[model samples]
Target: MKSHSLDLKSELLAANAMLRTVIDENPNIILMKDWDGKFLIGNRALADLYGTTPENLVGKDDGAFNPNTEQVDFFLKNVRSIMSQTETQVVLEESTNTTTGEVSYYQSIKKPITTADGKKQILVIANDVTELKRVQKRLEESERRLNYVLDATREGIWDWDIPTGIVTHNHRWCVIAGLDDNYLSHPLETFVGLLHPDDSADVKERLQSCLAGTAPYRSEHRICLENGSVFWVLDRGDVVERNDEGVPLRMVGSFVEVNDRKKTEQALAMQSQLLNAIFELSPDGFVSFDEARRVSYVSPAFKRMTGIDFSQVNGLDEVAFTDILVDLCLPTGKFRGFDALRKKRVTDKSGGREFIEVVHGGKRILEVGLRSSEASMVSQILYFRDVTHESEVDQMKSEFLSTAAHELRTPMASIYGFAEVLLTQELDAESSKEFLSIIFKQSGLMASILNELLDLARIEARRGKDFVFEVAHVQALIEETVHGFKQPSWREAPKLVLPVESLYIKADQKKVQQAFLNVLSNAYKYSTATSQVTIELITTPFAAGVGRRIGIRFIDQGIGMTPAQLERVFERFYRADTSGNIPGTGLGMSIVKEIIELHDGEIELSSNAGVGTTVTLWLPLIG
Candidate 1:
């Protein structure tokens, strides 16, 4: 009996020791309070909350260390009530650790218990749930935001249970499909039925691919409605749940109407193609650069104008591209190379550029313009336009102004000098008469030049609109003009060679007579009195585009002109003979040429220095 007692005592002590260890090491708050609210058995967790050790907390109430007197009172009341109860009761309590300054939420189980000493007590066990409560709040907020987004978008939503083959659709889906809310069918069958025949197979393939995890479930397709009308939709979803073996169990997605967006994209694509065609065919060239200042695009015209192919310059950087352009272009004012232009752009702090003239090769002139791109990716735009013809026109205008002024000044100077001499000095009648005659002749020459200029301007501006139309016999017209000509008494009349064939022309009679008189007068004015001028009527040979033409040839035995002079013989105010002795306005041939051309006739002249001059006026003959 003694050994048995000793063994039982050892077993009991070990059991008590294990229980003490289990209670002390527990993470949850565990304690026992007597009816007087004094802590009887306190674990390490409960003692730590009171800022005391389990050994030191043996007969102590929370009033010693806990800062809340109200909390202590409330707990004492609960302990008294629990002490009276026969069955266990539960309560939740909150506590704060003064040492750690940590607030904690706890789910506490309060139970009434009887100690070995026959004292009534309350036992409390609590687990901290602060992190779990915080997590629950966060989840609720996230759910609220997601639901708000869904409501705002108003997109058609669908959920599919892969394993059950069950599908659920929102009311928006039915509205989008033009179907009643009560409509029901197999989900896959309804989906396949709504797809256009052309897109059905591809959509199914892509869906299967998505299921196989090869690609994403994203597709744009046309959906046929109840009335045979079709609209485009962007259908997209992803696997929301997967089994442990990686099989898709659920998918969630939405449908959005993209009909208008698709149509706009198609129209923009067609417009882009048209612009590309224009760039390819245009004479102007363009170059585009990327954000890195590398060449991004070169139009076909750019390659043709610069003789550089995209294959040669593709992917070239700015400096390298500038080198290529420098090789192809001759420098203009303040522009040494493309790099210099880039610097200038930076200096000016502007994108707009003036047209810079650069000579490409020997004859071609190119005007270049540049605009810096404001887009984030594309950097700048460069354009080249061929302005060679416009440049030539500008140069010709300058020359015309200079030459016309020079010619007019000569006649004015002569008239001014002679008139000033007559005004300033008293002279004999013979000398005064000579100066007056000089002045009179110069004034008349100037008047004739001014009149001819006005007539030429009027004819060109009207383009034959002011002329009277008539038909005249070519031979009769020539004879009448020569009869009216004031033949210089010092020069003999031109010899006439008449044709027997009767030839007629459609022309303005006065204009035709005026042309003949000018040519005949030039013949008399430019030749020596002994020089024989002959007018010969000959038929022009048959030639394409020149129907049966009658040629009136005027052959003059006068001082002829060189090839250089012949080249500019038709120029206004240009004279083959620049000597002061030649008494002519320098406008006779120009006037004659203009009138003949206005009548749809042509003139041909041939001459050699000191030999003779031959001129033929050809007009279309009316049979």
Candidate 2:
């Protein structure tokens, strides 16, 4: 009996030794809890982690270390799940602290522990994952930001496996081709097939060069889509890895759609061609100079007319030409001793001088006239014409017109005023009516001729001044102007349509009224008796200085002018037909143009001879 008792004690001692060895060697935290959730056994690692000996921890509930009841409840829930066979293994994230107050992340797992007699307990294992969690979070954040940048810039990302010819593309790459995410794992041949036939060879060659390590893999090519549309693509990539034989093993690249940029380049190329044509074919000599007066560009005609070689004169400053001209003028007070040159006047020689003259080239003498744009205090553009023949003709015409106008104005005014007075006097009723009609018609004819002469004089003398602007109701102005044209002699009164109520516009009221009346009268005279005349008022918004602005549009429909008539419609006294059949002085449109411009507004006319005409007037709406 003594020997048997000693043997049993030794077996128990051996079992305890094995359990201690197992617990100490465990990489994870190992602990045992009783049914009441008290720590009954703890490994050396768990004891060391809590800064306590295993003996002291054995009888303590989790409150001794974890402290928080919530934490204890969480732990108990997992223990109960394992004990009830609801879960064979459970994982949870828990926060814990060592004696140093340093926070740590732990991935805790719980499992059921049963005694040989089948009484259940809880076994908990915890793995430290603080550094791993931090690294994972950082990686996820980096990926998110990278995706954001790619999305914002509309960049397409791709990866190519050189060995297998398998291509993987991100969603954006598909979107760029007007597709969806259904072709990510498509073969490289699928991409190659989409390339324009003309661009395919160059692209393949570039790829081959990259694979052979002979060049960087970058290229631009035109790509065709399934929808029969084409786009430009900028492909860029690098070799990610290489085999011992120097062949690329893996490659990565991006596809950026550059179709818009390509279109812009093509448009610029066309514009350059147009400019080149203009420079080569233009009759007038065109030149541009920098602020320093160095000639930057000159048309082909300029080179021919000056007899100065471009290579020798390209960078020559305008000061050099001015100095030469000044020297010539000082000696002869003329350009090469020409009489007309001597008669030229310089208003403010500080800017420059422009006049007509005859210049003598060494081989041939040519007549040249110069009229300059308003130059800055330092720079000028001198446009010249060969006007030797035109000057003589203009002088003769000017003298004849001056004499003729003086003689015609006196008789025309008397004919117009005297007839009006005689027609208004008493006479027999039948004779009175007939005579009045004749007088009225003759007076209108005379007035029309006088008005045309006056308009011609105004244009020749440049007598118009800027308009006076004021706030006025456009609706009221329109009504007044239309009322003035309401005479009873017409076959039928034209229809007047005003769609909207009163609208306020910022413009010169008198000038606006005159313009509206001219347009309305023209429409009435040209249209059939039954034709309708519509005037529409529309408003729109525009941007102003740190605020908003309103724009008013006046649209009209009536008998339209022909294309040729429209072209010269605004020229003073320029009648479309001069047969004296159309009752117009021809000065109305010209005056209308001058007034509208003075008010800083715009007028546009669209017309078809038979269909109808529409005049659109735009004026600012002011408060």
* TM-score for each candidate, following the candidate numbering: 0.52, 0.34
lDDT of 2 by residue, 1-623 (tens): 23543444444343344334334433346676766777767766677777787778877876788655676787667566667773535454554554765656665555554542246676565656565542221100000000000112246888988889899999999988677788877899888898889899999999888887787889988888889887777899889888888778789988887664454444334334323533343333544444466655555755565544456556667656444434423232334322233245354442233332323342222233332222232132333323333445466568757755654565466666656666677667786666667666656766776775665455334433534666888767777776776633644544445546566776767668877877776766666666666665666665564232233233334456689888988865566555555577667777677656666566777888777777766666665
Please write out the lDDT profile of model 1 over residues 231-300, one tens digit for every residue.
Answer: 7788888788888888999887887766655544443343343234335434567776677877777878
Give candidate 2's whole-model lDDT.
0.58
Candidate with maximal lDDT: 1
| Candidate number of the best TM-score | 1
Q: Which stretches of model 1 miss by more than 4 angstroms?
A: 1-262, 273-284, 298-314, 330-335, 343-362, 456-480, 490-515, 537-550, 591-602, 618-623
The residue pairs found clashing in candidate 1 are none
- Give the alpha-carbon lDDT of every model: 0.69, 0.58
